[model samples]
Target: MPSKNGTKDSMLEVFVYAAQDYGYSIDITLNVHGSLVTGKIVGEQEYFQRLSENFKDDSSETAEKIKDELLKASEDAKKSDNNNVEFIHLKNAQVYVGDTQPTPSENHFLWRGKIDDVNGFFLGRIKQKN
Candidate 1:
């Protein structure tokens, strides 16, 4: 989440699945237009569930809402083709609404940052070194 002055910057949350049939358990931010907001994949399934549950009313409602949000976010992301993945230099990284790094872990190589001030979350695949 992008923050200014040490506050939780408002973000729209969405889910990611390890496989299409597997449950979508990753929590990420989304743009109002329905794109997943960018950030490093630093959290786990429990964290994602907690975050998703926070935004939903009930388990059933949560699933429905998740699907809706995912569809909308996917379409929005597709429409804005320019919003796809990119290489962000970790040392040169910054949040959209703030100048500070989002307290990432060393396990994550790609620092997730917003594009176009749209506020969707993305996972930059770890760059492989040959």
Candidate 2:
């Protein structure tokens, strides 16, 4: 939930903070505005690792640059400690509208969203059959 008593849900904030600091994740489905976003919450380092893997074996300068930048961002996130969780990161993220099924054009991907934007959430994500 966005806010419980004028402040964001402490438990949810703790969840995100733990994921960022401990490299652990939990599958969750969230209601953001009207969209249904479902995914496995992951740490910044794990996110970068998965992303770098996707860009691996590309000899292009652009690919290397992207990987390096992501690595740096991951490191920076780890070092910073504001004690306030601002963003939520997810892997194998799927966003749905209504009852539509997944298509090749709409594949699961990494997602990052503002914690304050979430309205409500559940413990587990909706399993996509793609």
> What TM-score fits each model?
0.23, 0.82
Scored by lDDT, model 1 comes in at 0.34
Residue by residue across 1-130, what tens digits does model 1's lDDT show?
2223322223322222121123333333334244323343332322333334444665686677885665565445434423123221122122332333333423332333332334334444222232
Candidate 2 lDDT tens digits, 1-130: 2234554666777678778888779999888898888889997767777777767889799999998888887777778765666788898898877788632236678888888788889989887664
Model 2 alpha-carbon miss at residue 31, Å: 0.6
CA error at residue 19 for candidate 1, angstroms: 19
On lDDT, the candidate that comes out on top is 2
Those runs of model 1 whose alpha carbons end farther than 4 Å from true positions after fitting are 1-59, 81-112, 115-130
Instruction: Write down the TM-score for model 1.
Output: 0.23
Q: In model 1, what lDDT does residue 17 have?
A: 18
CA shift at 80, candidate 1, in angstroms? 2.5
